[model samples]
Target: MPKNKYSLIRYRVINRCLRERRYVTLQELREACEKALDISPLSDRTIEGDISAMRHDSGLGYFAPIKRDRINRVYYYEDPDYSIDTIPLNQDEIESLVFAAKLLEQFKEIEIFKTFTDSVQKLVDVLNIYRISGMDTVRNFIEFETVESNKGTERLPELINALKSRTVLKLRYKSFTSKKISSHIIHPYHLKEYRNRWFLIGYNEEFKAIRTYGLERIISIDTEESKKFIDIGFDTKKYYENVIGISVIDEEPQNIQIAFSEMQAQYVISQPLHHSQKRLNNIKDKIVFEYFLIPNYEFYAQVLSWGAEVEVLSPKSMRDSIKQYFDSILFKYNH
Candidate 1:
């Protein structure tokens, strides 16, 4: 690697000029670096030093096959296909790859990732081709948060195929509140994951409205080949833009303000609850945050998770709802 970031940038700029430009001169290389770096008056000697380092520097590991045409007085790579980017990965880079491959290994059994199983194994074998000791020991040092058995993952491949083919699906689903399993024909639109759980968002043909269903609650899924697929032109980004979690309510987005205790504020600031979260002026000793979102069960659950450390500050309806929850808890304790 280059000692500083600027040297690396200059190397890349020169590399591009050599690869793309015909008969690249020393002046042209200097101009390219100056333009890329947004600095003027880059000396010819500086560009020459950069080229020499790229060609000979063992530390950089480039050893680029750069050659100068004596007759035309131009620089070019001896190997037409040569690029610094194609350089072999260093030990650290190899280790990171090993880490990623190990993580993907955990999901190999899932139908959606079945195709990637052989590819991932081949990558692992390639990484170990040089007999790099301890290449397979990456999992010993790092542990990932993984579900031993994630329910409904088996349906992923079918759901993905349906989405691609724009096929309607008949689903038998059981809600947590009811023991009865209801059947519905849905035009699958989007799949979303929140807190490690998967949700299917689609247009329910029976209800004649867009709905969200927990994939875990889906007892069975069947392709409705006879029925016509509904194309609602669902914009995924716009649909979830004002929502915190999977439950996108019918109500308009509200400016919900919350105050957190100093202890909890640090955690909240480090990891924001929502993309629209913004820090406001502190209220007394508490740190305040504002969000433009349509509050749903997930949002409430998030706020309630903080327990005594959090307080809703605005929108009396939301405050009242949160208060009712706390009051019910207090009532249970009092009883």
Candidate 2:
């Protein structure tokens, strides 16, 4: 006859009953399963199969050491605390587990995953003790991009902790354009990743405005436990909706139209510059793209990167800006 459909569950139920009580008769075990585990009453043959399977089955391999009373026909574990949950794995199974642990360890460098470092290290220690075969070769087979830690990356742990605790932070910062250091107390809202760098979005207490500070510019950060956290209810999506990269300009979003030469248009079509990009009517040798966004520093830089292949078609102010930028660049090269 086939084993019970829920053979594993029956094993666990039988294991518990044998462990808890000094001795339990077959009928008593069935009653406990029905009441405590919400399981259907099992037959004598099914319970007997479960006990046999738990002892020898490679998947479980539980050394239950069950003893039976000859006079009363009751069963119990010789070692009361013994359970299938603590079963030891074979060498092959241990190596397989070690491989899985190594995979998780690879991602520990990422800022968001910093909290799991201790747990991941514990797992790695087990792997080292076992000295799993081909463990050294595992790192070589798979390669992960290791980004160098920038200036402010060392402060990630403290910043993340402050954000989690909802504490206000005091940051000593120095911008690239400025030599002097400035201090501001900010309520951190979000951590944004862009172009291989990290930025913190927060409510600046001194300026009374929402601002983004690049992690590279931060000189030092300390949390203020005494200050009550102030949440201005900033809408992240709407705030950055029309802006590109990390910059948020004060101007209203406008329709931005640009014409790209036919040669360069294909690349733009494949990978759109902005999420709000829409293709417009193409001229004889140029493909036009219309984007709805606020003109920010990053957006301006992106337009400049394309150089002569692209031209601003609408928004005269932006067109003038781009023209003047090119004129200056040309004058510098000529000199």
Candidate 3:
């Protein structure tokens, strides 16, 4: 372990002793930390320094009220009830926690999360307690974009189980463009979410290739008990590393350059489109940005969402594709 980890362990040990034991001697604290970590005897000087740091280190945020009895040479907390475990949270932190609790409440009815139901309830109870105790300043300051009629979230438990047990799945799916439903035998690899939609990414047995299926389009899902589960050893991170959203193509990543209007540039700078995005240069009134990514349907749609405020500078193929799309739109309007 690192030196900081050891120090943290020592601090926890000291805190436990101060909270539980009375008239704890400096020697006793050292012995306790050494025994807990199963290490060599810690010196008295080291123990004293630990106590000093715990009491005065503002970075630690644990300005423990520690005092010593001169007569008995014993140390203890001035407030018996004081413990690091019950550290006070600031108003902003409390509000953020309350908001998170609200989000977690949405998943309470899901079967897989039944174990966490009690934990989530406990958090709500704590928040309520805080509210009754005069910290009732928590408000609905943040709102999340939610899909009211989102489908397939109920399949999360079964999908998660199949992923864990390496179970093959039989999925009946219908695409947005298709009227007929198709059945597929898939080796479940991963479940992904993008823009309030869930998708199943897996190895399609019939297609003999990896494919993505939107959960909203799924009609039914069942276990393929007869088929043996084939694991492709999918590295989720590496697979989606270069792509924006959930569409992962087989092509190599392109050096994508885009120029954004000044207004849109501010938003891009604040919340970057991709991890690989970097500011290239300023041209006229536009801010040029660079991204190393595999162009996909989602990438095109994202660029299109900004409309005229953003322009794809290079990879002529991508630029032409966007131009063709605009031309088609113009042709439709003109016709």
Candidate 4:
């Protein structure tokens, strides 16, 4: 027999023997392989070469515990302590793990959710130690619902790619109310999703100002000669600090506050308008939930959603706008 083939035969024998036996005295390995695998194994030199090959090969080197034990002159597995066995995982548990991995990916965008995701991982691993997910649960599983449709299908993939590449995009956009098409040269800095709609924040080259554009309203996106956006950085938290809506704070700002009736307080508390929201004492007739913010179209839109349920308590500009909006909305239905 060829020397190489004889050494290959010796390699497989010692590999398995080492995991259980701790050490093989060259002769013992060849004898054991002959007994267990029913192969006419080779002599001592061949077994020695096999052990050397096992230590070197990346995959098979997992059996190096034998050499380490031999260095300390120790050999024993039969205080009956153990043996190497396949980790038992049925199909359902595998699927549950894949589901968990997908869930972690879903929350990858939200910076505030880091600690919560980490805690859930630790809790799941601990549960897995004792109870198998496939065997026990009867597959009473959680599923995330998709949006009705990909209204922004093509733009969605492009937006993600641009964010990854940090490239600039020229967008053909139409406003929700006004379908007039216009072009915007934007360097997309961040993507924000709120209430199932996607928003892009970027520095608009044409306007020479930072702007927020909705992905759904974007008619088309063209990759321009890519230029890096270095000067302008979007701090999502700071951007939303003083505003309840999508509109950025204007140069001249006011402390805009709103008061809600008892019926509306439940809804206001349920969805906080801003991070800086503070609750003041409730008036006899109304619940005053105070937020000092810039009054923008986005803010006005939110206020209008309340209809007669809320009242603007401060900043006369906001109050007047609310009155005008109410008049406009009422005219549509009342007239």
Candidate 5:
């Protein structure tokens, strides 16, 4: 085999060994590589050379952070995400990547993705180097509206790190109704984004409930390395599956019916209110839409946003709630 082929084979064997076993001795790696590749067992010197190349080879520079255990003479990758396969992209792959990167760049002004500014720029530079005129045409022609930056975006990286590592975080949070900032130790399970605002859903140690905190209202975050993270077995997808937005209430989904005017119904037909939205009735100028949701604050707020264009027809409780909300607004204006 050619030298390049041999090196590729060696890199593959080494990567496979590292991924399969947390730590592997030189002898163990040689045996595994021999078995997997059906090649002769590599000498100790050859294995050491392979490990060094994986850590420092310019073309395949993985920066693997492979560490050696002095006592047991074993090696393992310190960072699990580090991989040699992510070396470079081919021309077509790079084009597609640039397309996606530019699309995501539309939202780069948002704090959540702002941290990727340097990285995305670097990617753009790489793409630019390999880009053809067609790619540029595709990129320049498309555009997205840049929205205003939301608060607590600077802390996105820290919060994401906490969630990834399952590290307990001490948060200084100020709720919308609260006057003073309160401190709570939380085990962050998931980070969510809704309407440009970022939120952390986690189990609050003091409150003893899985609560959601807007990243904007978060005053500060301190990682509690000393505290062990607790997994409350919260299913984020399942949690928000029945709801429209982040505000989750401890209630079952109720069948919600809303009647909309012909003009508004056309818009709703094209852009659904929720995944659960379905047309229940349409007679003359009125269209009735049905949805199954938890009727959380977000749902009510959404209904309110439609104003006189929408009317809740069923679920007396929710209808009453909507009525009171409008009544209060009217009272404020009337007073």
Candidate 6:
């Protein structure tokens, strides 16, 4: 506020002008400033002073150079190079964006990541222009729901830097099958967002294998300096194109069917059980969703979330396992 009132008003005018117009006459700009900001009187003398202060005083890098023609005179923001390259969201994309931002806000651990954006002010500006504020900012207007897997969690920030710099990771992994802890040196190939959480798919250097490690499951990660990555052979995306649950499959993934009852069909449709889920039919009172995925615990858990509402319809092995899991749970609780 050490800046005088004129200087502050000048910055606002230039910001508004740059935002609204690429080319504007001095007269047009004067009227816009008066109308938008309610200046008591519009005079070229005051406007000229504002323009001068806009360039020298404000750090916004706004420049208003005067243009003259024999028939007319005008003023325009000097640089029209407002690149959309660095822009994160436009006026139309704020709602879903706000929802995602709020979800990340929960992970208090991921506060270390750097985003070159003024997201708060930008979101507020867009919402304000449309007269959206308060709880309506998040409530029902936009939502993010995760279809969590039984896959272990990793420390998110640790993986973020590894992904950013394309570095290898030394991890203390808790293998879900054996419940064994071991050290792994992995050359991270990709970081993907599925169901709200981030997953890293990489080549495990220790086992000479490929594995998908959930950002939340990473018990601890240390940046490995001595082990150098000479080559990363596989493309991250194509590696998981067939396998659904990141099970490190041996055979090609097969199509499977799942049937959900009317009671929990809404929740099934709300958060897709998998990225490839497709509605096969809505037969009278039941809903069926199908997808191609490896038969894994994560897939089993997806169906289990529906409790009595869902039943595996195909792949005999999966159906039997689902029955046994419930039977065990029932036996334990019934006693």
Best by TM-score: 1
TM-score of each: 0.74, 0.62, 0.73, 0.56, 0.66, 0.55
For this target, which candidate reaches the highest lDDT against the unseen true structure? 1
lDDT of 5 by residue, 142-200 (tens): 76666567778778878888878899999998999999999999999998888878889
Which runs of model 4 end up more than 4 angstroms from their true locations? 1-146, 177-179, 226-230, 249-253, 331-334
Put down candidate 4 lDDT per residue, 1-335, tens digits, no spaces. Answer: 12365455555555556665665466677687667557775566656665555545553422343333567543333323333232344455555665675466455344434447767667456545655444553123555654444355446667888878888888999988785899988888888776667788888888787898887788888888646654476677887777755668565556667788888887778978866577887778888877767777777777888877888888786788778877897899987
Score candidate 4 by TM-score against the native: 0.56
Runs in model 6 lying further than 4 Å from the true structure: 1-109, 113-158, 175-181, 193-198, 214-226, 230-232, 243-248, 266-271, 281-284
Model 1, residue 152: displacement in angstroms? 0.7
Q: What is the lDDT of residue 272 in candidate 1?
A: 85
Our model 2 lands, by Cα RMSD against the true structure, at 9.2
Sort by TM-score, top down from the best: 1, 3, 5, 2, 4, 6
Model 3, 1-335: lDDT tens digits are 12388888999999999888866999899999999899987799999988888898876778999999989999999989888777787555666788887777666654555679889878867876566454444444555545454677778778889989999999999999899999999999999978767899999998888899898788999998999988888889988999999888789998999999999999999999999999999999999999999988888989999999999999999999999999999999999
Clashes of 3: 0
Total residue pair clashes for candidate 2: 0
Cα lDDT, model 4, residue 280: 86
Q: Which stretches of candidate 3 lie over 4 Å from their true place?
A: 1-93, 106-122, 132-136, 147-149
Q: In model 3, what is the error at residue 115, expressed in angstroms?
A: 6.8
Model 6: per-residue Cα lDDT over 122-229, one tens digit each: 654555555344435562465555334333333555666777787878887675565777777888877776655667788887678777776666677888877787
Question: How big is the positional error of residue 236 in model 2, measured in Å on the Cα after superposition?
Answer: 1.8
The deviation in Å at residue 131 for candidate 6 is 6.4
Lowest lDDT sum, 10 consecutive residues, model 6, at 108-117
Q: Of 2 and 3, which scores higher on lDDT?
A: 3
- Model-by-model lDDT, in order? 0.88, 0.81, 0.86, 0.66, 0.83, 0.65
